[model samples]
Target: MAQLLACFRRRGGATASAPDEAAEDQQQAAPGPVLVELFSSQGCATSPEADAVAARLAQDSTGEGAVVVLGFHVDYWDYRGWKDPFASSAWTVRQKAYVEALRLDTLFTPQVVVQGRAHCVGTEQDALAQAVRDAPRYPAPAMKVTFQRPNPTTLQASFTGSLRSRVEGPGGASVLVALYENGLVTDCGRGENKGKSLLNDHVVRRLEKVAAVREGASARKTVSGTVQFPLWDGFRATRCGLALFVQNAALQVLGVQHFDLPDNV
Candidate 1:
């Protein structure tokens, strides 16, 4: 029987580190799907344009290199007359981690982080495109994921495989999984976006660290976990998808894989 590695929950306060360029260059040379993360808030007037850009990127599939888009709604703008229903403080912390890793000054709306390597204004299509184009490529994590619905409002996922990239030094690597929704429409009644109809896709609803690869850990291991969803937030298998990525201690994304929720889940 294969040994199931113990997985731990993610904790706050870990200092973020910059990417290691030398180690990154030694990974697989093949180009893999690019991860484009958009940080925006519905309460911000400028977010709609960035959301539209993300939607366009999500629909683009003609290019040889694939792109994976995830929209993270931050809660900082909630105080501006109207609270964004999709916003979460966790996403804000995640963005701040990137800010610290990239040595940025502060947070801003409609920001895009590409492959966890670079950031730019999300609404600036040219800059976003350039960042994606310049981002380093790596082979996909050789893993297989299976989903199970142990109960309504809860999702159980089991993953097994080897992380194709190498991990050296103190903090090891992290296996992060995110649940995102598509085709969402919101009507803003107040705030800067008052009376505007906002369309958002690839909105990240839940994020979890299912497994951790400690320093000197084996290359291949099995891990699983359950993600609980709020009853108020509807879960439609057809409208939701999952994205998993292997990120090293320096905050560089080593590999990525995406999966659509099975209709029956």
Candidate 2:
């Protein structure tokens, strides 16, 4: 099995998009879909626009190159009066980790991290798109995922993925997966966004680091992990799905992808 996985990883291919303003920044063809992380807050007045940018990218076609966008609502702004129910301390920790890994002085909302390589103010629409275009492409990992409802209040899913060589490096790797919901709206009671009903997309609900890739493992490392959604009953949103990110030892990311659940199964 290990030898077979290694052979498959070595056979992975790279693809180049047509050179244009959008594709100029990339060094080579991406191996998989680009992952975009939006660290935002409902308390932020400018978060709406940046949130929309994520929506646009999520609908894009991958035949060109797939893109996965996740909105991580941070908790610091909760004290502002209008607590973003979607906000999580975990998300804040994730952002802070990036600040130190990227050597930034501090953390801020409305920030977008692309492929964990490049980041910019989330509201910078043009730069966000450029960053995605400029990101080093990795192949969309070969993913297999399925969901089941064993009993009420319990949602379970099992997912597996095989990483590609373009996204791997000397440093080892880690796989992080998240559960997100779409078409969510928040009616702010107090704060800068008070009196407004805000819409958000791909709002992450749960995230977990499931596995670690060894330093000398198969370039096409394969990992299988399970994700549980405990508060599943409370969320009433369209297009609930799962997303995965594979990062290297330095916390730099290789790439990411998303898997959506069907209405019936």
Candidate 3:
């Protein structure tokens, strides 16, 4: 893990390119959170193994500032036999964008994309392990956000974060916050698995970008905004979380953070 982290340290490109105090400050301000995204479907028999990988990574997300997992059930495979209740066309579109971004020839089930930069077969445990360890090359803006459930169905959020002027470049930056669900199970009736049941974690329910960051002319740039989400009965029994990430307009993830929802609240 240390070796992987060393590889991402700003040497020439993403890391500290200049041997100066300003460059060192930029490196220190970058938040180090890894990201793991799994493109899967209920109809794909191999997807369960990938799903398990995501769940395991999410478990570590809190411990080592490890990979923040997101399991996206795409709708393309719904026609195979049993429709994935969690599958969404929007999710499929997101996957497609990755297809272009990552330079993949096409899409496939059980594909694990790490840090939105590297990818491997989800079931390839060894490769996936290395990918997760190697994430965090792109420095994230330092950020903080809190979720408050005002009532049973509505959630209000307050966010505060600072972006380094060096990291955002001249175009500016933005952060995407998402409400995700976990420990979700679905019993497949007529798909490839027939009678099998599927359990998943880090399933995204809703996501939106905060307003464009406030790019200050000084060394310390920042942004702020408020957003809300409507909770429903479908989220009643499961564990949920809020994840926030900063990214440039080019679609590269800069930094990320995740907050698990409390049942007592």
Candidate 4:
């Protein structure tokens, strides 16, 4: 087992750039907590209950700041009933990759992957909230990420931050770049869920870990990267947005935010 470090912030606070402010205009925005990622689909009737539970968790930022919630709409359920408008193959691939990387046997919907190392049923609120509270508080990552939005579909991000190993720990970490989208809608047509309309927030469309931060004795460090949107059928690039976060190798979330969409994807 990898040794977990202490890099968590005592307080829950995040800074946003101009693009973040713009994205906030569309809907309510919050910062990172124990990042609870829900892999769900609009076509699954069981998802709404899980989604509701996740949404409530997202709202609770009091005890441990704010619980950052991200919904990754997966396309695996599309053939059952209604094809979820937000579902994407890329999102599905990301989930599968995590399974392989983490060495898991099975994967399913309404699955809540906490931080990156923990998994729980999405509808289980009590266990979920408690897990968030118990999560380790590792030191922040090596980069502080911020986004610049020239338009509604394009985003330019800057990562200038530092990561410190725990009092006596490993000297290296991985920084993940994830593009989170919010304010999504989907109509249920065929799967386990049919004839139902749905609204989603903080949904991750694409997730790619762009870099790994090597901890050093230095006081500060930095890295840079960019995420571009891909055009999909019935999915307009405008209503969608992005978020970038840097996490350690143990999958502990350190930094996160909603990236403003530039004019062009």
Estimated TM-score for each candidate: 0.83, 0.82, 0.79, 0.70
Model 1: C-alpha RMSD to truth?
9.5
Best by lDDT: 1
For model 1 the TM-score comes to 0.83
Q: Give, for candidate 2, the lowest lDDT window spanning 10 residues.
A: 1-10
Which prediction has the highest TM-score against the true structure?
1
Q: What is the full ranking by TM-score, best candidate first?
A: 1, 2, 3, 4
For model 3, how does the per-residue alpha-carbon lDDT over 1-265 read when each residue is reduced to its tens digit? Answer: 2222232222211112112445557466555567778899989999998888767665544434556777888999998888988888988998888899888899999998877778999989889988877766544444555556788887767676554434444565667887888778888899797888788877887777776753323335556677888776766522676667765555566666555454444
Sorted on lDDT, best first, the list reads 1, 2, 3, 4
Better of 3 and 4 by lDDT: 3
lDDT of 1 by residue, 1-265 (tens): 2111101011122211112336534433445567889999999999999999877766663233467789999999999998998999999999999999999999999899998889999899989888878887665555556666677767777776566556544798888888889889999999999999889989998888868887655444444444444423666877877778878787887677677666666
Q: What tens-digit string does per-residue lDDT give for candidate 4 at 1-265?
A: 2111111221122323322325433322222345668999887778898988876665545433455578888899888757787788977886786677567897788888776767777888887777777665433333444444565554445555443332222645555555655566666566676666777877776666556666443323545555444434445445554444556554455554434344333
Clash tally for model 3: 3
Q: Which has the higher TM-score value, candidate number 1 or candidate number 3?
A: 1
What lDDT does each candidate get?
A: 0.74, 0.72, 0.69, 0.58
Give me the runs in candidate 1 sitting further than 4 Å from their true place.
1-29, 62-64, 168-170, 215-232
Which runs in model 3 stand beyond 4 Å of their true positions? 1-31, 61-65, 138-141, 149-152, 164-171, 214-219, 263-265
True-structure lDDT of candidate 3: 0.69
